[model samples]
Target: MSTVFASPSENGQTSGATGGASTSAASTPRRSAVAAVTNRLASPQTINFVDVPAQEYYSTNVFTKSVMKDRLPKSVYKSLVRTIDSGEKLDPEIADIVASAIKDWAMEKGATHYAHIFYPLTGATAEKHDSFLSPTADGSTLSEFSGKQLCQGEPDGSSFPSGGIRVTSQARGYTIWDVTSPAYILENPNGTTLCIPTAFVSWTGEALDKKTPVLRSMQALNKHAQRVLKVFGHTDGAFVASTAGPEQEYFLIDRNFYYARPDLLNAGRTLFGAKPPKGQEFDDHYFGAIPERVLAFMCEAERELFKLGIPVKTRHNEVAPGQFEVAPVFESANVAADHQQQMMLTLRKIAEKYGMACLLHEKPFAGVNGSGKHVNWSLGSSSQGNLLDPGDTPHDNAKFLVFCAAIIRAVYKHQDLMRAVVASAGNDHRLGANEAPPAIISIFLGDQLTDIFEQIKGGGANSSLPSGTLEVGVDVLPPLPKDAGDRNRTSPFAFTGNRFEFRAVGSNQSISGPLVAMNTIIAESVDFCAGRLEDALANDPDSLNSAVQSLLSEIVGECSAIIFNGDGYSEEWHREAAERGLLNLKTTADALPHLASPENTQMFAKYGVLSARELHSRLETYQEQYCMTVDVEANLAVNIARTMIFPAAIRYQNELASTCANLKVVGFEFDTETLDTVTALVKSLQDGIATLEYAIADDSAVAPEDACRHRCDAVLPSMLSLRETVDKLELIIADDIWPLPTYQEMLFIK
Candidate 1:
């Protein structure tokens, strides 16, 4: 049987199946998408660049040390600065003075209310606003913001997902200000509000938010890292801290196209999109010229971020069309996490104003590169800067070698924990897809470091590789200094000169969870190393260098299996990893169960990062999230297939039948091939929809793990089957009569 595939035109117009002119009777969505493109193209938009430098407006809205010093008393400023810089406990007496100063500053900025902002388990920021007004006895209002209000807030916790932390009857939760992260003024056209970063906890003192565990992990890491610094004979009474810089990636689509698709709106991804004819195949989009409108939106978003103390430093076009990336300067992990949330918010808000919708979904469109947040992490101190940096002579830099060895051991010991932290419903769609890293966690140490470690494991390393110079072929170009080694983009955890970049984190996920896991695991490794060094030094005080060398050699030999310099996306790597006894958890359901393992529980508990009960609660919550996400997507596929796609296909089928019948009446026999194809596809779609409905309606009581399995094993496959038939119908039906927007229109039109 000969088949005709009704491919869409460049502008989304379809050729009629009956060998006649295309009809425009049912092209509402397509017409709308086209109009949006035309309108945006005709009217170019530009941002009004400010005359002042960005440095002038940097941290203007933030309550930073400079602002506090200018506003508060000298004594109060000293005390607060000590608490912030030295990790000293806050003084209660300074709270009222600071609150008074903050209220005055906010009132001067035309503020009427203040909000205690916290990150909830829903992976979104939550806030509760309270007016800074109190009625006097004489019926007149007085501006009032007390120390108690500044420090704590009460929000109803019953509605938030607690995973058994807070029962229904126990609806009380408290938000305490996290002084480590500075407060900022969120500006609006009508009014401005003071946004204070905080940590949420239940009445029973259990951590009910992501910030608490992150703060605890920071403390644990700081304690052990300080011990290591002291052992290295570098004790300057400076506090050690972990720093992070997260690179965010996302897609931009026209608002009209976004609103027309229910799947994109509800599931944050397209449930039924056929592969477009052109899709990032030429690799021309990576670092290509930025579109005018997208650049404008990025500029305005960066302006907002700069005013709020987020040092957004880089922006560029990504590997996929309509996809882009932005990165900020490094800061403390706690503050960087807060800044990342604000960056996402700013991207979305500015996109709306520019007639677009920012998509942070890991895989919003299929058959293309997805989004990921590469978190650059490191440890540093005021006294000993950048412990991870391997200077010119890495073999002689014993301190740096010891720290690098600790990282390798940590990754080898807690690979499951690293995977568990980044596991989520959205991430499962991106990992091991040839674009992002594989599900198995591995470290990428460049040639220099890898060779040094190999030498150490074999015996001793007395020399290091020299930096080479790249000589350009042309006389006009000058020779440049080459890096010690080439970068490995395929590695999930890669050493990039002075820091490690975790490339497996999802675009839409908060960085706090991954940071917490990393810090806690490293703390364990550092503590173990410090104990060994102390014991060795006690045995032979004069042979300190020999003892350090021996310890590092042992660690390198044990943990060298996780260091890979090859492609992580290769199938051979997957087989080799399994042979090496590494875990390849391919899905959120497969990975989240590791959070409750005995080793993980004991590790977190020993490091004071999380209790067993808290860990269990987190695992349950994540599993439930995965199950619900799959359930929602399955139902949406069934609903759209039945209500929208099937009707369009049937309408076209009737048109084909009517045309054939009229042709027959006129004594002209018509070909039945087009009608037969449509008829068969429609029947298949109906059958697939029925099977999906049955799968969704199973409604049996089961464990969370079992529910996740049911959703993945049964419901997801059924939904895919339905999508296959529906997508096939999309290609065959008349584009004028197709109800949904085509992939070409959504992806290329922008």
Candidate 2:
């Protein structure tokens, strides 16, 4: 056996040597790689299953209402519940009692340190830890947690990405306790820490994080929803809240592969790799049997989440190999957003223990199904459950139509805003691909709902489709009752029974942005409907039902363009959508600018969701993020192609040249076809690398939007060209000499 020398790069590609005769030198890395795979496969994890019942383990570390009631005085507990339930201002006097109870509960859970965790503008969770130990005068330590410390914490804001909100001189920021989101104890093998959920803000009191906007949007939504419900004769004072159930999708690859791939390590994606022959084309991976190793990882991760009060409900194989999904039951939008972040952190942490790395990138692998966080959202109050649910009666159905009409109007008027919320360089690769939803933000009200809306537009919706049953061919199978509507997987926004699933949200993104946009736009539409309905009622008090029907009719007729039940991914639908005057903001560069449009500015300002300054800052930040992401990926492509791939190709070419020369010298004719092909590809690769290098060297300072445009126009195309040549080379290169892990190895080996 010939020894193969492999000099892999940071991203796991052999950069130095291609082929060598010394077996020991070449076999070292090869032996390591093979050993990694063998060890992982043979030594499966053995999780020690705890004997405790699930109900007892659930929410054990959380400071739940039950815990609060048990720890705090009756008066304090009642006061806190009032504030939580009614969304009223918290009473400062009760903070001491609440803080003491929370501290006691956390201490009982074996926590000695506490941290105020906040969601910052970087689309990630941020925290600053503090010890509970306070030194006494005699040098003894006392564990003390004050009310002021529990309510607020000052962290240096200059380090975080504030979008220029905080200057160097003004580096102060505060994390204020969000009572709605419960505090929980984060347990590690070494110790446990009390994690308090909070909202981050700058010194100027501007909204500096995602949670602030989400909370404000929820308030704005509740006000409008309450007004509409009041007009419909519902006088209950319960707070209306938006609910979310985000289905998180991710990929799990062995840690050895992750550490070797520089592109995956730095950019969260593969910059270069030939498409695998056995991709997701056959659709065999979707909902298939879970690999034993992956199931064990999922079980341990779920157990950790359960203790933290995250109600994770479903886990299964996704459409692509190595990809999977986990969904949780619905909760209030604020709490669900927090739990979604926690779930992502937990998955990544637990995967490490299982010797795997969890990938949350939107398109971790090319030519396969990408990941998306389908944010299932709905609005309701304690009094009127699930405002979007259409009950079995005519009156209930009419009420549902009114609320649904509000969503239709919201989507029609603010499709650009919806597209802007999910805009990111990573997500741009997934959206409009065959695997995910199209970039055009259209609402999918299934067959039954579409018919009802059409009838309303004509004049009134007198009836709805009745539920049917499905009968299998075999007599042994039981009949399954059909749902009111069939799901349209291609639509970006689909009405899935009781909730509208925003399918375009990227897996790695925070749910707060999408929830804020959804709530605010729906609030605007609801307010519009309320004003019109009030006017119609004032004109003729006796015809309330007729007035409500007329209002819905007008809304349906105006916003009908956004309601598309057909194939959203089809060319015909694209053309028809354009004919209907809908905007298809395709890329992050194209969609992000819409965030600062005058209409969006006014909407955010009017609803108190975000100020004009904050909105513009966010747009700038995203544009900068997009430009940076593309620039890094482009640079990686050029480096890998020039240093790692080009050398290997040349070495192989040298081997072929020497072989051809020797054959001719020995009086034998040799075909030069292979040599000619390799030469031509090398030349093209050189040309592509030159173009990319030139594109990246233009270091002119410009506006953020202009920078993003340059990246999209020049840098991106050059990167793709370089990748095209390199991937082609990968297909032709010798297997043992190829420096990087093949798609087959990465995607299928596990």
Each candidate's TM vs. the true structure? 0.95, 0.96
Per-residue lDDT for 82 in model 1?
80
lDDT of 2 at 676: 89
Every model's Cα RMSD, please? 5.8, 4.4
Q: Name the top lDDT candidate.
A: 1
Residue 625 C-alpha lDDT in model 1: 90
Error of 1 at 65 (Å): 0.8
In candidate 2, which residue ranges exceed 4 Å CA deviation? 1-23, 27-31, 41-46, 393-396, 699-701
Ten-residue stretch with the least lDDT total in model 2: 1-10
Which portions of model 1 miss their true places by more than 4 Å?
Answer: 1-25, 41-47, 699-701
Local distance difference test, per candidate?
A: 0.86, 0.86
Total backbone collisions for each predicted model: 0, 10
Give residue 345's lDDT in candidate 1 (0 to 100): 93
